[model samples]
Target: MRTDPTQPRLRPARRGRFAPSPTGDLHPGSLLAAFGSWLLARHDGAEWWVRVEDLDPPREQPGAIERQLRTLEAFGLVSDGPILRQSSRDTAYREALDRLLGSGAAFECWCSRSDLAATGGLHHACVSGPQAGRAPAVRLRIPCGESVAFDDAIQGRVAQDVGTEVGDVVLRRADGFWAYQLAVVVDDAAQAITDVVRGADLLDSTPRQILLQRALGLPTPSYAHLPLIVDAQGRKLSKSTDAVPIDDANPLPALRFAWRALGQDPAALESCTDLAGTLAAAREAFSPACIPSESVALHNTGVAIAS
Candidate 1:
């Protein structure tokens, strides 16, 4: 199960995906990521797919996934295949974990969150113990002193000391649900995802996922982390932060604004008569270099309050 760094298997290149958790309505931030990912796939002439990461039942809001899908359709962002729901892939994840366990690349740890919190989140508590089957979470046993590095399409040549920056991270949670790092890595490999475009909020977690990719013997996908939209106070806009969701009732204005937020100068509001035209103009003018690398606060004007 140990990922041979020198000989990591390179899968045949294919398309990309946008995997979003259905915890809330699609907000402006999420829309930015979706649009960016969609455009990237289109630019490469690759099939774009969508996956609903609904593994955490407690955090998933009822009906949120359907609402998000409708919103994406409203925004004119379509995917190629039937939407893949993570909840339906439990058997696949379980088999991957079993393989890792059998190969000794993964180990069961009974350490609770509280236990790890006390030791700064990276301390190994169960390196050696009786193979107890107490409701333990599975953790990828990271080899100490190994560095995981990847050349991010946007960030460029990023690296992290996996042993210290991220400890033996969890594959399965104490609640028996699979952790995002584990599921995302496995799914991306399984789906043959070539590129991953997401918001900058996940920039810090990229190195961890790279380590997981190394551990799981999977091919790593190219990544482009888009700039995050922040509030006036510099906080990332999220449901818990009370950030407003994208209004599907009138999406043109919001789409226009999102294009601007990503550093595109669209035609004036009066120029484009409809949403489709505005987005078409955007796709033609979309350039990754135009978007800012850092988070910025967008004024809630035409897009946020469009009738």
Candidate 2:
């Protein structure tokens, strides 16, 4: 199932997506990503989509998907198309993996964490031989000195040496789940997504994903990594105790906080009293240049509803 060399990758319509892993509830930090992505799509008159990254069943919480969708609905951030869940996308991932494997761009590695510990956890070449019952993790075979560079829409120019900085990346884990790097690339191309807007926390993972896109011959989407919302100690809100789920019972307060965090003027949403109006006004005022490159502190953002 190698990528047809005859068909060249073409840029599609502007499509952006907010992909959230259902490991926990949607906090303000998560809302910032959701809101920012939604606003960007609306501002560009593009299609916005929501995909649940539910590939890891063990880390996912029960009933989290339903709650996450409900929270998005409460905030008026509905997807332009039907929601896509990674759990149901196994066949597509397999096909993409097969293409990479057939092309010699990917390989099965028998290395475990301990096997690569001495080499700083980078799988240059598999050190451990295949075990009797253990399955080998599939990883993209990054050639020596291979590098990837892209101009981030918001973060500006970015570059990384794949072989040295990231080593070979896993496409399917030893635990029998499709890795995020592979699943995301496959899904984005399948959905014809042209733009990717998410938190800066994932900025490092971009190069790895871009490599996968090239390997699969899929069109790489424009990426904009938004600043992450951190806690008092400057920890990402999602990793801190302050990552409490924002109250959907009153969505405006949370929306205002996210809007302001995105560097949008509070005055833009100040006059709007409801979610619909606020979103409309915010969309008109949204500007990618206004987004700060620095991480935002949670406490620094005032959560009080605009009077």
TM-score of model 1 vs. true structure: 0.89
**Cα deviation of 77 in candidate 1 (Å)?**
0.8
The models' CA-based lDDT, in order, is: 0.79, 0.90
Q: lDDT per residue, candidate 2, 195-271, as tens digits?
A: 99999999999998998898898988999999999989999999999888988788998999998899888888888
Candidate 2: stretches off by over 4 Å: 1-12, 305-307
Local accuracy of candidate 1 as per-residue lDDT tens digits, 88-170: 99998998899889988888887765666766778455644444566778898876676777776766777888777677888
Candidate 1 Cα misplacement greater than 4 A, ranges: 1-13, 127-134, 239-242, 268-270, 300-305
Top TM-score hit: 2
For model 2 the local lDDT of residue 273 reads 87
Q: In lDDT terms, which candidate is top?
A: 2
